[model samples]
Target: MEPHTGEICAHSMFESEEEELAGQAQAWKYTFAFVESLAVKSVVLLGIPDIIARHGPKATLSLSQIAAELPSEKPDVNCLFRILRFLVAKNFFRAETSGGANEVRYGLTPASKWFVKGGAAAPSVSMIAMLLMQNDVTMMAPWHHFNECVLDGGVAFEKAHGLHLWDYAAAHPDQNCLFNQAMACNANIVMKAILSKYEGFQGLNSLVDVGGGIGATLAEIVKAHPSINGISYDLPHVVAMAPHYPGVKHIGGDMFREVPSADAVFMKWIMHDWEDEDCVKILKQCRKAIPETGKVIIVDTVLNPREKTALDPSMGLVFDLAMIAHTVGGKERSEEEWKNLLKEAGFPRFNIIAIPALQSVIEAFPY
Candidate 1:
């Protein structure tokens, strides 16, 4: 007998159910994305990449040798082997069989090269390391009382430590140094990408790096472009401790109060550290500091929701969370949000030049 229509429909419905389950599995891929970061952190803290890098090109170290080099209380060598196995799977390292069937030697991959000691491109290691370390008891402890922070509508860092980030930095000299190092390391990666890709800095006679910590970005720019004179502006404490650099002058003052006058003002990764109102106030000060013909070059992430599907959007999303956890009401901005902030701050026209790095160069001009 021929099959009835209702039975056929029911059979099709069951097939659709299986397909929906498959689709849900694919959609939940990001739910497991934290594994990659944890693996990277494990390799970093274990100092495996640095050891392989010290061994030179194509050099491989056996698991036992690696464990011997580590301090006492090391995890079992087999467990280390498992970690290396996962790293190999992630392409952070390469593993090969030795003469014996049981022996396996590990080598560094291109991705692992940056984690090598004294490597120029080691910003990711510095950044991840800082995040893992600083977010320990001192920082993460506040999150338990995050409800208080939210209810009080005040800065979380203050709630956690009884002062804002800047104030806390001023009081703790060692923590301040660590913060500067982290910022410098992050700036190194960003500025290197900017100097290589962007053309806007070519003709500028003078530039000011507003909120520039230790002048890392400006120093690179001046070294690359001989004709450009630069200024590194920050708070008094930061400026007093600023490292010396040829051709870049250090200026100490509050950006909200006043900025040193210059042909162009550069603010890298600074605006997102403050709220919209605070950003507007700082931008207004920046507008007054530069000439009408001069530009205010802002280096920050332009959060694009559409681009969240891409590989690097994880970095953007992570940074957005960092802002929330560390600061009060700070956030990464969208293009429209940026435009409104600029316009509200009294800037008439602006141009966005996308750097190959995570941040973009936003040049705003006064009317």
Candidate 2:
């Protein structure tokens, strides 16, 4: 082998044109990844999905037709066309242009169908609110301090906003409402999946959903299982906003102090926001709330570290990093970590059930 005379740069490392192009493709794909998210947000903001849906079943509307449906007095057709084209490539919408048609037409895909407002496919948490919150300036600003947060052991959200997330939201009611709406929408999807498959509530007379924000999730459950009653328990302020649903009652209190006694305690997406010690405390409180025969139902991501070949866990890692960046000491956990937490919290054993959703269900028994 001959020694290299010059420094090996990124371009020099690629042996062939094919390799260089491949590297460039991967690099540019990542660089432009956020564009897809922003595109989704834009589509929601413009109410394109709803507009297209109004055109009737399997409707295909031309660019001019879509523009006519918009609220703007003078809609920018050219820019809107550009955005529609991008979304079309991402499969959020389908594009069709005829030989005689001067402009391209678009139609909704299955994914985009969920964004149609007042459509049966849409959830309580509007798609517009959810998209805006996910890509919000306040939330995304934390990523700028990603490295600083690790080195300084500082809360990234606090560093970005000069206050904790909850405090910031409390001060900004609009943002808080947006966050809650997104959560409620997400819970609606998850709750349907839970009822369809899981038997966690079987034969149980009562279930208390801890940190149940608006009672929408449990309200559906109480209606589904008329023999059982449900309670949505959260902080006083959050519980105040819950709508009155028959068979499902709302209670205001602190989970750390006490959770309303029930045959089963259900908590979803709550533990990942707290550290290990805090989780133990919360689970212990849940243990006290349920009887010996009853169990605690937890719906959260269960990190499958050992599943190296089964499925892509990129979504799981995204949430895990989010916990790190957003919380004081929160993180996703492996199965071993979950077991240890359960044992420490006075639960002798537990069973984890897989669901088609983003989170798993863990049924842990009382001591």
Candidate 3:
């Protein structure tokens, strides 16, 4: 709570001459990339974004003011400022152009606004859970064994933790909380975009959210479209703790074996967690859960090589490698890869609906 004491802020250092040398700047930047993630996580954990937002859009919090909002009254203000400086450079927060630590006031950026709990686009578990998960000691430990894993065809995660991801999460309640919370937060944000922009859910009468975790997304869907009855489907243990929402039923079962029958089956961020063969098996199971007119709607990012924006394909690429590093056969896929997988799964045809928010929807129909 006391700012984690002192450590060298390597990212703050700069070199004028050698950085200009070919790949030197880029390489050094890459080396210190972990600092950016850590710094963001630190700020989020310390409620920096929330404090700034509480001060209102027009107001700003000075370094001392921000520090006061944190856990300790006697925290080292200078160290906090150093972290703030890194965040400012990363564009997560904005500081005044000409002011000392005492005078410089920090304010939330457009991006940081989402970190505020009750803000317009606030997601309860998004940043904190995601940041912590990526920088997790357990998850990072596997990277050290990646070379050995490559040579031996062993799993980095299994090598590090002595078990696979799902098994590890099941055995560890704390890690499971992180994964579920992060997933729920992501669903909250992405579903809002889907409901606001997309029209595919307009006519569906019944829907089942396959691999829905605690049913956050389906809860949102049921609320948005009250006419549609929703089933929050996931593993037995997950549904046992799922929150009860009106018009939404939580059913416990294995998706690979059976998904509850519905007019539409929803799978968000699921296929990316498995290889093509496994993905096809899950899709085929979903197909069984629907009738002749039914469809399996995929709510996940479509890796695009054509356009680059807030949802960078590069970020998706890192996620792909991360899947390789952490899970058995999980990885992100391109549109072509998705289509081929769908064909293998016995789905006749599919349509991709693009939304401006976080992920695109791939609707695969049973013909």
Candidate 3 wrongly placed segments (more than 4 Å): 1-20, 97-102, 119-126, 305-310
Checking candidate 2 for backbone clashes, the offending pairs are none
Ten-residue stretch with the least lDDT total in model 3: 118-127
Query: What is candidate 2's lDDT per residue for 26-134, written digit by digit as tens?
Result: 9999999899989888878888888887776388899888998898999888999899888898898998877574657799887787777755355552455666777
lDDT tens digits by residue: candidate 3, 1-367? 5575578665445454454464576888888878887788777888878777776865688887888888886898889999998888889888885455347888877777766665533554345666677778887888888789778898889999999988898888888878888788788778877887778888889999999999888998989889999999888767766888898998988888888999999999888888888898899999998999889999876787343446655677787888888878888888898889999898869988877554688899878
Against the hidden reference, what TM-scores do the models get? 0.83, 0.91, 0.89
Candidate 1 local lDDT, 294-341, one digit each (tens): 889999888873333223855777777678767767889888999999
The order by descending TM-score is: 2, 3, 1
| Candidate scoring better on TM-score of 1 and 2 | 2
- lDDT against the true structure, per candidate, is 0.80, 0.82, 0.81
Q: Please rank every candidate by lDDT, starting with the best.
A: 2, 3, 1
Clashing pairs in 3: none
Give the top-scoring candidate (lDDT): 2
